[model samples]
Target chain A: MSWQLTEQDLPDLARGAAVLGTGGGGDPYVGQLLARQAIREHGPITVLDPDELDDDTLVIPTAQMGAPTVVHEKLPRGSEPVDALRALEKHLGRAADATMPIECGGINSMIPLVVAARTRLPVVDADGMGRAFPELQMETFGVYGVPGSPMAIAGERGETTVIDTGADNKHMEWLARGVTVRLGGVAHIAEYAMTGAQVKRTAVPRTLTLALTIGRAIRQARERNADPIAALAEALSHTLYAHLRVLFRGKISDVERRTEAGFARGRATAQSFDGQHELELRFQNENLVALVDGTVRCVVPDLVCVLESEQAEPITTETLRYGQRVTVVGISTPALMRTPEALAVFGPAAFGLPYTFTPVEEAAVGTTA
Target chain B: MSWQLTEQDLPDLARGAAVLGTGGGGDPYVGQLLARQAIREHGPITVLDPDELDDDTLVIPTAQMGAPTVVHEKLPRGSEPVDALRALEKHLGRAADATMPIECGGINSMIPLVVAARTRLPVVDADGMGRAFPELQMETFGVYGVPGSPMAIAGERGETTVIDTGADNKHMEWLARGVTVRLGGVAHIAEYAMTGAQVKRTAVPRTLTLALTIGRAIRQARERNADPIAALAEALSHTLYAHLRVLFRGKISDVERRTEAGFARGRATAQSFDGQHELELRFQNENLVALVDGTVRCVVPDLVCVLESEQAEPITTETLRYGQRVTVVGISTPALMRTPEALAVFGPAAFGLPYTFTPVEEAAVGTTA
Candidate 1:
């Protein structure tokens, strides 16, 4: 499908991306503003399905890396995303034909849109990760044998670095992370550049439209005075994200947060409204696990989203504060994420959790409207 | 003066460089061996006076970054220096017609020679710093006018990173240091690239021949069974390094070491052979300061050299050990480094020393022979 993203779509895209961000892509406010401003200035953006691109067309993924605490306060100069793309293009001595998101969650998802709007380049419908993960190498692109560089990391502070190394994808993540830290713990990186056919073969397909639909569903539910949670389940169920369930419903009783190694990390404890049960959430940028009363209720590769209990507004992990009323939703990740190979890189073990992963669908039933 | 460096020059060059290294720049043994091997295979290297170059010719400086312990143990793949130069060339889209040293001290001084041997590009007689100062921004080039990047840093693991930023020279050093740490605590950096005219105006003139001459003086002193310490002071007094003195003479009694921020850091205490006095030496990569019973003696912007008491071999801080007899010599820094402005950056205050700087010559009487 080919689509044009006008300013009107910004709210829904940011909302859905926040939900998909599963608490780690960082706050979408800045990303949303940047995208809106760019679109308003440069006209609507043409978003293309990966297949719409010719085999030789070049596509690059754009992302902002840093602790959410830092990115939230130190807004980008807005030129960063495009600057990173141009740097990558210069490094290649070839121009990128389109832009794509490295992940479908948080601020990262919106970055590509901003670049596409400003450059009037087509934006790819797919992303490297169907949902957000904490680090660069956790994407399906790496698990499937694609190298991350020639990647470019450009900072708002007039620093542009290009790395073409024989290092493995994980090492590439470390190298990029180090550079981000030096650039005031925030930088725009355009990496994992691939040809259009490689994008089709490796990227998680159509997450952009899925995010828009998910955003629209919850908004429509609020308008109709229906259950937003049920609307969320149906919205996810209709897409490749085929399983959804509310893993916990509670009021946040306690929360701990620490910004470390360019990540917003901590645990959140939500107490049951009935005072009989509690949910414990562990996160490193994104929520990795949810345990209810010492029982493992959800684990990755599965999407764990925290939403305000009544408003159903997506509460990213960075925004999780004490005394908030919330419901945690679990959606089975895209099939590409559940493969044994992909699981090896992003499963519970990869996050240093004790238990192995279990599909959210297998762990719960009757989760749809 | 234009000259060709035969393989026989490697020993004296390494010897003088180690002395100038002033207990930093790591062991030149490996660098010397590498240069010897390259010269044997690629034949003689042309060494050029900065004035000999056409005004538009490109000149790049090459050096290794990181702790001596790690570099000595891991060793480079031998291609890193050339690889870094080539990467810089590719980044600039202009081939380098000549190469130079960022610092004419320790292992860094030997890098340009090795590169020159391999590429047959003339090695410039001038260097960024007449002596090493442990950081990149401390170069004379940046203080005068030229920007550091279009600088390229290449790793032995086949990684080449180019950093192009409008950041100040100090920030460039920090950024490059950060990258070096990620590339396994050691990397080859080709930075402060400039045109031949810029090199002639900013570089410390004839520092290469100075290193070789100094090396030959100490070696000849040992061969003649004369006082090597006196010979060293005489050799330095005869050149632009117009002042020299023995700051302390003793046997190593105690040493402390720790690796921090990818730099070998520690203090060594040398107790006088007669047992009345002791000198405390502190270093980060190279010797930064020396104190006699808590009184400041030699601070940065001046050269501090540690030599084996018997053989006159330059004992770099990395190889400092208990029970070795040694003489600590101090030489007035090049006139460029002693300026109030330059000292403000590489001075005693810059390195966190408590007192104002006093030139070794001004502080010691009858210092020159």
Candidate 2:
């Protein structure tokens, strides 16, 4: 299906984008504004599925690679992503046939639209990461063998760096970060070289559909004054099992932050169930694991979202703070993240959890359903 | 040259290990203890250069991949590396020709010896990182195209995982961390598929020689009652011109810490030079960069070292705290790390700095000798 960005798609896209963020994609507001501005200037963007492309179609998954917190204060200058894509195209000696999101979460989700609108390329309806992560390589696309280097990183100063370091995605992220910080903490980067066939092989097919449905669910919940959790559950009828639990309900009592390797590393302690329990959340870039009463209940690759009970809106780990009431929800990772290879990459232990292979259903079994 | 470990190697090894740690390789005490014990039990390890290897030889870089803090308390059962290597060999359906350290900093420097003594394989007198970094993939070897995954990750509990998510190096780090945490925050890992050609091409040639010399200089300094800085400067003659810089002479005032993505991330503000100067250090699995007076004085791939004047010993960022008189020194990165390609991966920008390369020499020409 062709995924065009109509005015109607904007709201759903923003809402869905936030959910797919996995509690780490930067504020969707900035990205939303950027996308809106671009759409208004250039009209709706066109999105295409991998199947719609020619065999040699040059598909690049573009993103922002540094501290998410930096992105809020250091807003994009409108031309960075477009410039990055052009730089990448120049490096490749061929124009991009399509553009895709590296992730469908945070600012990254909306970035593809901005790039696509400016570049006049169709935005792919899929992403590298099924959710957001802290680094460049933590995505479904990378797991499926998409390269992150040979990447074109563009700054607002009209400078572009085509990073092609072999196997060191962190270094690339590190280098990109310098430019981002130089550009006042936000640099537009376009990366991941793939042919249409390669994109079809690696990407989570139809993620745009999922994004739309999830976004629609959140919006519908708000419009009808319905329980958003139930709406979300209903939306994922086939993907999620019937039995899901609200693992803990509490207010954040403490948050500790430390920036390591330029990525935020921290933990938040939540006093929940009317002070009867405490849930601790650990993060590096993205929230990787959640510990309830000293036992790991949710781990990376799965979605560990902290939502406000009243509005059901996601609260990013960076935004989490003391005295904010939140409901911890754990959703099982998609099939792509559950494969032996994916689990080996992002499973519970990957985030330093002691347990392995316990589905959210099992991990949250004892919690209130 | 055939290298043999001895009681004399420990002190020097510790000193050199800290220098190689690049500021965040974690406490070397435990690694030294483990290596010393292993040496006492299994005999001194023999280190061989990669050039001596046969073209068909199998070389595995083995080390602990997890939080250094957790490693101190969760201590290994002495078989984690051996187990990880054995599992690796099993997966490869062959025996390893040799083993080597991924980094020469902290525990990683000694781990090669532990594995060598246990497996009866020679430890290569080279490493991936001349200095230590905080994650699995932020190494020169990784930049040289060493794969960090399809790794053999093992725990003392007999648990083993052969991770093969075909992502870049950082993803492997995340995956390894997940296992480390699953195993209670530490795991022995054997990763990176290296051909003999790669071993010879990328392994920091004769790093053990450099480590030994640095160690010897420290020992000599203590014995002769000479200045350790002078001794170290003399020891690092090859790279000293660019690497050595006295960046700060201050006492630590505040230290903030929080864990993210299985790493300790934080900054230690040091009060030095009769003024309040903050040396901001960021670490993942190792220290990646250092900022002095809000400007990046040194970035990754270069040596960012914090030392205590009392003994001229290197201090891990985790242990850095208030009341500690620290002399922040910047060691110029090797020529290999300064290449545009390398800079694209490990420069100031790579560490999330907003500045471009202005060698430590240029930045602190007057502040340092």
Task: Summarize candidate 1's per-residue lDDT along B240-322 as a digit string, tens digits.
Answer: 99887787888899989988888888899988877888788888878887777666677787888888888789988778999
Please provide, for model 2 over A30-142, each residue's C-alpha lDDT reduced to its tens digit, 9 standing for 90 to 100. Answer: 88888898888889988787677777788987887667767657788678888788877766677888889888788888888888887788888877777787767666666
Which lDDT tens digits does candidate 1 get at residues A134-215?
8988988887877888888988776798888753777778888898999998999889988888888888999899889888
Against the true chain A, what TM-score does chain A of candidate 2 give? Answer: 0.93
**Measured against the native two-chain assembly using Cα atoms, what DockQ does each of the candidate structures obtain, in the order listed?**
0.80, 0.02
Each model's fraction of native contacts: 0.98, 0.00
Error of 1 at A249 (Å): 1.8
Each candidate's clash count: 2, 25
